[model samples]
Target: DVKVTQSSRYLVKRTGEKVFLECVQDMDHENMFWYRQDPGLGLRLIYFSYDVKMKEKGDIPEGYSVSREKKERFSLILESASTNQTSMYLCASSWDRGGQYFGPGTRLTVT
Candidate 1:
């Protein structure tokens, strides 16, 4: 069975603050992704990592970065959070061509 967990279910941050969102997957999947969900824009990919220490920028990568130093853990970093950046962040892991397992989303609010 695959299980994904996020460090926080809800988070609040001030403008310009550095924020970190952590995700962990137990399945040892090779692919991990970070995405943010908004009302109208839907899910926007922020970054993805194919393997340890190997990351690629997704659809919306500006002001954000990612780390995958360990196979089971992936982290999303917000360099400087802004109000517009507030959204529900999701983490997912999967094998090549396999269905992705997603963690409980972390709702982030930047004021």
Candidate 2:
């Protein structure tokens, strides 16, 4: 079975602080993605990596960055978190176009 786990289920941060959200997958998937979910805006992709050290910007990448130094781990970095950036972050991994296995998600609050 494929398993994806996020470092935190909930996180709190102050405005302008840097934040790091981590995700790890056990399936050795070749693709990993980071997305942010908001009530009305729906799920917006932040970034994705097809392989180690390779990243591509997704729909909303203005305030976010990502790292995939290792095959099993992917990290999302918020350069400077803001109130508008507060949302539920989700990590997903997939081996092909079939489907993605998602993590529990991290609910981040920026005050």
Instruction: Give the runs in model 2 whose Cα sits over 4 Å from its true position.
Output: none
Clashing pairs in 2: none
Cα displacement (angstroms), candidate 2, residue 57, comes to 0.4
Could you give me the TM-score of model 2 versus the true structure?
0.98
Give the clash count for model 1: 0
Q: What TM-score would each prediction reach against the true structure?
A: 0.97, 0.98
Candidate 1, superposed: residue stretches over 4 Å from native: none
Error of 2 at 39 (Å): 1.0
Model 2 worst lDDT run, 10 consecutive residues: 92-101
Pairs of residues clashing in candidate 1: none
Residue-wise C-alpha lDDT for candidate 2, range 74-97, written one tens digit per residue: 999999999998899999999868
